[model samples]
Target: MGTWSARPFGNDSAADWAYELDEASDWGVVSDALRVAAEAVPSDLDSDDAVTAIAAAEVVARGLGRVPESAGSVDAFVARVSAPPPEMVALAVSALAVAASAEGELADLWEGDPEWLAENEKLRSALTTE
Candidate 1:
């Protein structure tokens, strides 16, 4: 996974996904990532897809004015893409839940890492907050 930290964009997959996000002309990229993760069979979810979905959820949180202090590249993404629709917050939350669940590769990879789990919960909290 080439992960160096627990943050959403702290991995190779997420960094690559961030580049795609920067090149995207609209919000569809974000929605597509979230939708794909959210709709995946929990037992069959890929780690790359899970990572990208979490990154996409981070973008949605930023669009909703919930930008974290350590947003990194996601801040730049928010500046380029228009705000995500309000409905996306729910989708983002759903994606996070599925991606972080025990059924997915990401969850298995992060199995004993409390820091990774905490980071995932933080992103979910950002999306669910009013």
Candidate 2:
């Protein structure tokens, strides 16, 4: 996570702030970067593949932290993440959102991603059964 002062975004709701942030930015560049960086992620992600994707996503998320917390920043961050399947995308978004927060900035980002952990477990289990 990058540096962000403890300043309110002048909005009453955090969700609203995040929504506005997403709408204000040009996310194409970020999306391209994410897609290109995550190109190595296989369709059937093993643990390592999942780790790779998560790492790529984290880099993008962390980069976004440098910008002010606004709709544009959210848009840029979300756009850069190349997670497919609505579930994976949601997971990515949630994880990124948490990591982008003040508390998350001070904590280990991946360690807080329960969804990522669950997904990893699911993938690992599938690998063993197959």
Candidate 3:
């Protein structure tokens, strides 16, 4: 179907980690990624790191909804998005879209899983359009 790249999202390094989460279907890993990212957030959260953190948090949020494990990261992401300029919001949303657009061999683990796919797409659309 379609190809996706994480370069546009900033911190391509984390993209593979994100894909690994989807590929492995491990919720524990989700908690870990988000926790690590959240712990790193400071008052001076860089736009690049913020984008990466938001993208990862979006994936966890999509998978678990309002999970306690991801609460801090999700909260951080929400705060960052809310306070940023329109362009920053757009950038964050675009990163989420890129993550949602994941496909091919890397995303095969999530393919045919309608619920998971829909959740990702729903979050992606909400960020991009709202």
Better of 1 and 2 by TM-score: 1
Q: In candidate 3, what are the lDDT values of residues 23-91, reduced to their tens digit?
A: 443344444444443444243333344444455555443333332323243344433332333443444
TM-scores vs. true structure, each candidate: 0.91, 0.24, 0.39
Winning candidate number (lDDT): 1
lDDT of 2 by residue, 34-119 (tens): 34323422322232223323333433333434222334544465565542333333344433333233243222434456654554
User: What's model 1's overall lDDT?
Assistant: 0.85
Clashes (backbone N, CA, C under 3 Å), per candidate, total 0, 7, 0
Q: List runs of model 2 lying over 4 Å from the truth.
A: 1-43, 66-130
Model 3 clash pairs? none
Each model's lDDT comes to 0.85, 0.35, 0.42
Candidate 3 global lDDT:
0.42
Candidate 2 residue-wise lDDT at 85: 37
